[model samples]
Target: MRDRVTEAVPELVAAAVAAPSMHNAQPWRFVHHTESGVLSLYGDPDRTLPVGDPEHRGLHLGCGAGLFNLRVAAAHRGWDAVAETFPDRRDPWRLADVMLEESGTGPSDRALADLFPAVENRHTSRAPFTDEQIPPEIFDELCAAALLEGARLAVPSGWHADDLVDLVHDAELHEAASDLMQAEIIAWTRTGRAGEGPETEGVPAYAFGPRQHDVKVPVRDFGLPRNTERRATATFEERPQLAVLGTEADTPADWLRAGQAMERILLEATRDGLATSMMSQPLEWPELRSMARDPASGLGFVHMVFRLGYGPAAAATPRRPVADVLTVV
Candidate 1:
């Protein structure tokens, strides 16, 4: 078992790091204990976004997404991964402890293994989507995907949707006025030409997509700062399809679960031939986040807002090498 785990750690970590993070920071690390066959997931403190995610909620969510991908990779390799969140209270950085066992397949294992292909294929699309309505069945599948990870997916419509859009705009105005937030975004966004430098992490200029001609959705303009390169403009969908992912309680463990759910929904959307992007701007502001939730949905705390529809797939973002984020014992 140890030998098998040793051979699989690299591939697993590779898929894990492929999971999306705030500004593509990729704030996650993996450590494998060969003797005990235990794989540990940690939050990379150095990669944190202090201004954008001061409370580290987004950090834990990113790490949780990585953890979900690790499980998918293990299932694809025919290994059963039993995972526990916050295994050590003394070490807050140690987010999860996973025990890899060689066991026979089960229904849930097969279900997770099915999403393995999407683990690498999924990319956050920032381009404009056409004004096409998603089928109700597809939304149902996405909701089930969130529920599988112990979270709720709510589709806000009518006046609620309009209110949510207003909240997103409010958050955008706040970001525009704050210099610290802008600096944080600039720090994580690279404007250099490809191959000019290592540029392994951070959202590259190529992935910024065309600038929105109108602000119908909550897409962060990474090119907002002065002196940044200008991008082509395109009109985005007027009524952007949005969904809210939430959990019953707001805690570290719930944040991690929400992250897992968020990734699962993204992968499922990718598999279904849909383009997806995230809107965390409103959620970043505590005051706006409270108002972002739908009063009719009966959800407690909303963790993420996702935009889904048919559009061009996004360019793949860069990721740090496995050696930079993994250690073996």
Candidate 2:
């Protein structure tokens, strides 16, 4: 079993690295223990966002994406991945341990298998979406995808969408105006370039998606001061579709679930021929994060704000090589 398990290591790491991250910052690591067919997922503390994601929202999102990828790879290889969060009570950084099982229910694997193709194709589209509403049925499917991963996607209506747009714009302005936040944004954007620095994984310049003539969907200007004057015209559309991803709890485990659910829903949407972009601006502030939830919906904790619709697909961002992220122990 050790040799057999070792053979799956490369594929597992490849799938994990395929997970969507905030600005493509693949800030997670994989350690395979050959003695026990247990793959440990760890967060790269050095890659954490100190100012922007103080509570590790982005960190969890990045790791969750990796987890989703791991599941997909496992399913593709005809194996079942039994994951336990914080398997060790003493080690907080020990995120999870994935035990491989050969014979098991195919439900999870089936779903992940369906999403396998989207692993490489799914990306964050920063460009404006056409003023087209995603079909209600497709929306329902996406909602189901989140629910399967223990999360919920709340699609806001007319007034709700408008209000969220305002909240996002306000939060974006606040974050952008602050020097500390601005510096962090610059760091991630600049570091996004391949081989630029140690922080090699992040949203790359090419995937910044052409800048809009005027802000449309509350995109964080990655090249704010450096290329503020550059023109990458986008046809801003009115009434962008808005959906919020929420969890039942707000613990580290819940965050990890929410993050993986996010990628699952995003990939499902991408497979359904929809373009997507996520904005955590409103969730950045406590008050604003609360506002993102709908009282009528009975969901109080919101983890992510996603925009979905038909539009141009954004370019793929750069990613760190598999060799750099995977290590055997």
Candidate 3:
């Protein structure tokens, strides 16, 4: 059974690495033990954003998203995956341990297999969305998707939406002024990494979408410092549709759960004909993060802010090769 599943490790990791990360950093590494029939996921400190993500929250979230993809990919290949996060407290780097056991009860997770296609198709669209409201049923479905992953998806309205945007604006202001944060953005962004260089990671110039001239929700201008891209300014929606994925507690585990829920929501949204992007700016600031969630309810910690609507797909950012991020035993 181990030998059979060992052959699938490369392709499974291939799909897993396709998961989205902050600035396309791809901050994760995997070590699969063929003998034990298990895969261990570790956070790559070298690839992490220290200043921007000092707590390594974002890194954990990215790895969690990758873990979700791995599960989906394995399910699609007819493997039963049992995952345990934070298996060893002493080894903090070991974020998760996933056992790929041969399915005795036949292929499990056929439902998750249905989502395998969306894993690759989903991209963060920074472009303007058409001002069309999603059907009530689809909106409810999106919320349900979050619930499935032990998270809450709050779709703010009226003043709440405005307040969230204000929080984002405040977060953006802080990021711009902070030299450390700016440096991380600079390191990850490129002139044309996708088309040019042998660069396998980081967001490329083309994926920057456009300079948001007038948009309700905030879209980070990754090319603001360069000014060389000559990217055009585009008009976004008056009140852009936004959703917040939150957790009951603010911890590494919550962040991991949020990341998985986030990917589930993004893929479902894409399948429903919605373009999506994530804004973690406000969440970065401890002061502003509380305000990011619904002020009235104050239910959970805002882990990620999502922009969802109809728009062109953002260009695919480069991902690290499977070999670089995964080690097979």
Candidate 4:
């Protein structure tokens, strides 16, 4: 195939792995075929939360975000990467395959390359945002970004937003009362003080964001095991901004598209000087997930929930080195 999957692709993989994963598990694996020049992405079964994602939907979303980053990296490098969402019908774990090569001018390439800067800066801001309102134009732009990836961004209105908030609280209560969910949180979070040591993955105690003293913060509280003495309680903003990312279907391919769309929306928001965080608590539960979307909007499947606004950027979480996640054969 003469694909240009060369020695330098690992460096590009660095940017791909930076895409956020559930609990920073970073479950996706990339294998580059030296001779065929085929780079394949697979979801690591070892890194999963069975209780929360028995279907591995969250893992697929993370992998899709990483795949989007890979495409952007390839575009920035002047390489046209041909991607197949699922190359094998029988292999459920295989997520995607990419063949990298040079190509002539294409609008898609330029469009993806343009997002390189946002990809570099997009982050999950667990902190509170100001009560300022986002302009209508920005909302339209975000919706357009999602549409580009074949997904929909639903911005809930007055009553719907309140309904979503209540649903989120209900999901939180469900998780809090469940031992398995709490175990998963404890398994993937660090309890040590901030900057305690070098960690390649997992949500650190520092990123937990201040314990929400106010009842309205949409950010998930990761202090379930309760490290009360070390963590501080900071009042979160009232009337926090929220949105939902959805796909037309609930299949693996749909989840991948949703993930890419989620990242695109987040990057666009970042470029517009907005801080972003995710609230998948409601979406993790089937009953709660269904209630998250507005029946009036007729949105299909809600893949992710976004908290967006003007605020301080959250600290960058650690990611595995490119070598750890990529295998060369």
Candidate 5:
């Protein structure tokens, strides 16, 4: 059993690293206790976006997404992964500990195992999506997905959705005016020519998608003044189908749960043949994040805003090699 667990560590970490992160930072580390059959997750302090994610909320979210992917990958490999978050208070960087138990009968989480196919297929679609309505039933499935991970998915409509879009616009303007924020974005974005060689992390120029002709939707603009000629212009959905993923409290654990929920929704959306992109612009600022939630909905803190529709598949972002992030003992 111990040997089996050790052998599965590489494949598991590879799937976990495939998860989305802020600017593709991939801010996570994994360690396998070969003797105990335990896999541990840690947040890499160096990979954090200090300016954009000052409180480490986004960092926790990214790690949580990786955790969820780890769970799914384990399930696919016929192991029941029991995860505990923030296992050690003394080590703040230690995020979660997952004990891999062999499933004697079958996969413990068939639902999670079913999502393994979508794990590799899921990519953040920054490109424009067609203006078509997603069925209400699909929204229900997504909401259930979030709830399963201890979070809520709220679909904002009418004036509420419009208000969220305005908040994103406000955040964009705020980012534009703040030199520190702009510098942080530029640092994580690659705008080099084709022959410049590939980056192992960060959003490359090809994945930036086209610049929106209008501000109908809140797609982030990563293009700097130096790369103006490289980006093409296109129109995005006028009234994008937006949903907010939130939790009752804003703590590290809550952030982690929200991250897991967010990834679950993204994977489920991918399975349903929908294109998806996330908007954290508004949620990055405290005031804007507060304004993002619906008072009537009773959601305390908003973590991420999702734009979902039918659009072209997005270009895959780069991820660090597994050898750099995993350790075994």
Candidate 6:
């Protein structure tokens, strides 16, 4: 069984690496013990965003996406991948452990197949979204996807949207003013890397959305400093639809769940003809984060803020191949 599963590990890691990250850092590592037929996940400390994700929330989200892919990969290979997150209290590096299970209502192999294509196609769209609203049914479907992963998806109202936007702007400005934070952003961002470069991690130039003359909602202008001028003029939409994913209890497990749900929602949206981008700026701030959650909705805490709409799919960014991220014993 070990030798048999080892053959599947490469494809599994490839699927897992397709997950999105803060700047596409792809901050995850995987090890498979062929003798035990087990796969262990580890978070790359070097890939972590210290200032942006000091609590490792973003790191967990990235890792969680990888875990979701692992499960899908297993299903594709005719095995149910059972995941036990953070199984070892003493081993902080053990993000999750995956094993083969014979029976379960796992995701369909067709869905897993679709996921790989989606993974390759899914890019954060910083481009302008049509002013047209995403249908209520689609919104509900995204909400359901989050719930499936034990999280809540909150769609804010008029006032709520304004408030959240304000918080995003505040966070962006703060990051800009702080030398330390700016340094961290610059460190993660790279123009181009040879084979694999130090700055090979963070957000790339192509992923950066167009700079707005005045952004009401606080989306980061990753184009700042390096690219003063917008690449192509985008017809900015008046009202951009935003949603947040939350959980009732905040724990390492909750963070992991939120991460998985985040990917699910993103993938579902992609399948439904939508382009998406996310920001956790407000949530990084305690007071602002609490306000970001809708009390009326009675959902859990907000883990992420996403902008969704119909737009051109942004260019696919570079990723360190599966061979670099996975090891087979």
The number of clashing residue pairs in each candidate reads 0, 2, 0, 0, 0, 4
Q: List the candidate 1 regions with Cα displacement exceeding 4 Å.
A: 193-198, 226-229
Model 6, residue pairs in steric clash: 23-203, 247-300, 247-301, 248-300
Q: What is candidate 6's TM-score against the reference?
A: 0.92
| Candidate 4: C-alpha lDDT | 0.85
> Which residue pairs overlap in candidate 3's backbone?
none
Candidate 2 lDDT:
0.80
Query: 324 in model 2: Cα distance from truth in Å?
Result: 1.5
Per-residue lDDT of candidate 1, residues 34-141 (tens digit): 888889999989889898899999998999899999989999999888898899999999999999888586798998999998988899988999999999999999
Pick the winner on TM-score between candidates 1 and 3: 1
Please rank every candidate by lDDT, starting with the best.
Answer: 5, 1, 4, 3, 2, 6
Give me the runs in candidate 4 sitting further than 4 Å from their true place.
1-4, 193-198
In order, candidate lDDTs are 0.90, 0.80, 0.83, 0.85, 0.90, 0.79
lDDT value, residue 9 of candidate 2: 85
Candidates in order, TM-scores: namely 0.97, 0.94, 0.94, 0.95, 0.96, 0.92
Residue-level lDDT of model 3, residues 1-329, one tens digit each, is 78877888889898888889988889899999978888998989888888778888899889988988898888887777789999999998898999986554443377678789998898888888899987878879889988888888888888988888888889888988998888778788878534433468777778887888764568877887566557888888888888888888988899888888888888788888899989988888888988887856555788888888888767777887788888877
Off by over 4 Å in 5: 104-108, 193-198, 225-227
Model 5 has how many clashing residue pairs?
0
- Predicted structure 5, TM vs. truth: 0.96
Cα deviation of 99, candidate 5, in Å: 0.7
Name the lDDT of candidate 6.
0.79
Worst 10 residues of 3 by lDDT: 192-201
Best-fitting candidate, scored by lDDT: 5
